[model samples]
Target chain A: MIDQLIEAIIQKKSPIVVGLDPRFNQIPQAIKEKCLAEYGETLEAVAAAIKIFNRGIIDAVADEVPAVKPQVAFYEQYGLPGMAAYLDACQYAASKGLVVIADVKRGDIGSTSKAYAKAHLGQVQVGNKNYQGFPADFATINPYLGDDCMKEFEAEIVQEDKGIFILVKTSNPTSGQLQDLVMADGKHLYEKTAEIVAGWNDKICGKFGYSPVGAVVGATYPEELSALRAQMPKAMLLVPGYGAQGGGAKDVINAFDTKGLGAIVNNSRGIIFAYEKIGGDYQEAARKAVIAMKQDINDTLSSVGKQYW
Target chain B: MIDQLIEAIIQKKSPIVVGLDPRFNQIPQAIKEKCLAEYGETLEAVAAAIKIFNRGIIDAVADEVPAVKPQVAFYEQYGLPGMAAYLDACQYAASKGLVVIADVKRGDIGSTSKAYAKAHLGQVQVGNKNYQGFPADFATINPYLGDDCMKEFEAEIVQEDKGIFILVKTSNPTSGQLQDLVMADGKHLYEKTAEIVAGWNDKICGKFGYSPVGAVVGATYPEELSALRAQMPKAMLLVPGYGAQGGGAKDVINAFDTKGLGAIVNNSRGIIFAYEKIGGDYQEAARKAVIAMKQDINDTLSSVGKQYW
Candidate 1:
């Protein structure tokens, strides 16, 4: 799956992963007006409109980008109906040959963690009933519970060919307060976490020279991004904090290897809700944002003496 | 709400919070048979059986405990219908006058966090339509995204007079690998987080001397719990890792003050699924587990010269 994802990114020559974090307030006014007119403001109707909006964006960008990262919180805010829509969207993206990275950040302990892994990553069979998992190519996970909790996930990755991006250094401002704490060994917590991430990935390296175990190192910390990248050479990097979170192409360039095959830059607000920021027709605004981001990343990589795949 | 929760715990002289993590496979044979006879194995029927089982447990132990913490993952694994049952269980437990602490470790950035907070903690005002929040008296939150992510929840807590317990030191074995990382400033990451938790609660101190902002300091880390308690004197501690997770009553004693009004020990599998461990009638096994847990906590507190209420 990691190899497929890397190949798609290389073939498309795009690092931008449109973040599907839709907010009702951020939807273009025209689209919102049309959606409200078509389907009243009931939760179900609004969620349907959200799905329509997301589908349109995915269709517009599918041929030009490698993947679409859907932030689960926005859809979950609408409850179960919303989650159903989210699942549908994942299927929709996968049907278009796009990698669907479910940004859930789920973490728990032991059997519970296994349940979550089975629920989201692999097929779950109980008696005569069998349910398909979330159908995501990869998922973002919280590593706060420690490596032992991750064992179930690691095992599933091997058995099911799934991938996991463990949160190391986050993009938020306050992340430094804790993730940047110095360890007794004189390394930052995130640095130590990066070392562990590299170690974990060593056990799961795939055919593409990259591992299914990845690290979520924030694009917000460019300097740390380079350092962490150097440390976890074999690990893929899921770089969040781009665009809306104030990170730019230059900041994320170091996150990738020289081949431009090791990183995926995520921009939730910057891409999905671009019409809100730029104020234009919804589809056109979204298309323009995706093109511009793709070019920006390509140019940045090129300048760093790395060919854009 | 913290004050109310503490007062309730002290008045009941029980620190045990019954954890509602119902696994269909692990359910007693009799309960399974009853469910099969009464309802089918479809999600709706299964959820109904789960609700009945949870209601029975709540009925048996409502008078012997302060709260019931339901892990959302267990219910969420069953999808929409299961979520509906979870909501039903929450409403039922609250109607029994038990503080419902939803163990949904949700966390995200800014506005998304606000939506999640609204979904679980604050009310949802859909245009002219009115709806209460999940109606839980309190909720457990994930603080991995940083303090800013918690601001919206803080506002909701102040407005609704509810409470939130932030994950500071989790009980999982691997938690120490990141949480216990020492900083250049000499404070461990969790300790720094404890200081922030204390700051967040300073203005919201309740009449009984506790604050709305609480810390989840795992009982497994007894020494860390004592240290965190010394730092966040005014914050309530929601201790997990009791019973099944390997923490005992004596281990969590440091989380409370001499008044025995500061901590609520959570035992999910240990109480609700006690028949698996104790081997007796389902209800009787659960009742005995609760009684034994309460006695153990009371003895621990009393031995330390702390009055239970």
Candidate 2:
């Protein structure tokens, strides 16, 4: 999975991954009204609007970005219809030849974690038949339960040749409330979390010298990102908090390796809602937004003599 | 919500929550074969088996226990069909006059958390009307993202008068790998997390002198459970790790107040799969299991002069 992601980044000359985190209101007025007319303002209408809106986003950015991350929370609010829409978005993104990352942030006790691993990354057995449940190229995981619980996801990654990004430092305002607490060993909790990621990453490596077992460090904290970058040297970073979350290209510059290939920056609202802020077709605007974002990030890397291209 | 939960505990003379975390193989052969005959070898058959098995368990324990917690991971592995079964189980428990606790340890950034809160505990707006997503009485939440991210769930609790349990010390073997780390303040990380919980719980209490805001302190760690109970005085303790997790009734004594009314102990496999160990009808065995579990818990509490009844 790491090799494939790296290959995509090199081919596109952009280490950018678009986030398909859509809100109902964020969907174009035209699309929303059409769906409402068709489904009579039901949850089905909401799902339809999201699917259509996501289709536009994927078509626009599929050629520009290496991956598309769909935050499950956004679609989950509408109930069963919402889940259907979430699955459709994932399938559509895959059909476009884009790496689909399910930003699920799931983890649990070992036995339960095995079920979640099967839900997102592997196959589940039903009598003599086996079926995949919401399969994706990568999924996000929560690490609060520690290494023993993560064994299931680790096993799934090995069995399916897939990937996962475990949370280290999040981008929320109070993220440091717990993450920055100094431990008895004089290391912050997030730093300790990064050390754990580095250890796990060492057990698995791809052709590009990166691990499929990656880490998520928010782009909101540049210094912490830089520090974690050095701490988990082989980890591929899924750096969220870009754009709408107040993380500029310069703010996330340190997330990259010397060759500008170790990180994928996610921008959701800024690119998907570009049409609302800039008057034009939503798809065309999203396409332009992706191009502008890629250029901004590449420019920052080049200024530091780290641009691969 | 806390008052209602307290009233139910008083009426039932039990502070027990039956965990409906079923594994497919654990289902009685009769139920499994019936579902397989009905739906063939498909995810539908798996969902059918879960719904039927859960109904039997709920029917057996509804009069004995005040609440039932349905862990989502077990159902999620079957995809859309599994999710449908999960909702059915929640609704069935509610229909049986039992409080439904959706044991989904979900958390994320504020926006994402809002969607999750709506999905499980509150109403989501669609166009002109509001629709429910899953609508459990309470939901378990993961607290790795900190307080700012929790504001959404907090708001949902306030608006809908629902409840949530935040993970403090989990039941897994390696939960201590991160939770038991000594902080610079000379306290464990879980202790600091308990302090945070205590602070939040103080704000939103109910008529029963308890808060709808709760904390999950595993029964597996008796010492930590006792300490956390003292730390978060007003917060209800959702104690997991009972029964099949190697925790006896005596092991969970510390999770309660002197009245033995401030905590709910959860037992999954031990009660749900009792027919496999003890003969007779599955429903009858489940009823006897719940009765024995309640007696074991009450007797332990009485020995310590903490029995509420």
Best by lDDT: 2
TM-score result, candidate 1: 0.94
lDDT of 2 by residue, A169-203 (tens): 99888898889999988999999888888998889
CAPRI band of model 1? acceptable
Candidate 1 on A1-309: residue-level lDDT in tens? 889888888888887788888776666666667766776665666577778888988988898888988887777667655677788888899999999888878787666777677666776554576655456888888877678767878767888888999888888887876677777678988888887888887787978789999999999999999999999998999999989789999899999897766899998777777777887777778888999998898888888788656
Please tell me which predicted candidate would have the highest TM-score against the true structure: 2
| Candidate 1: pairs in clash | none
- Could you tell me every candidate's TM-score relative to the true structure? 0.94, 0.99
**Can you tell me which runs of candidate 2 are displaced by over 4 Å?**
none
Error of 2 at B219 (Å): 0.6
Provide interface RMSD per model, one decimal.
2.2, 0.8
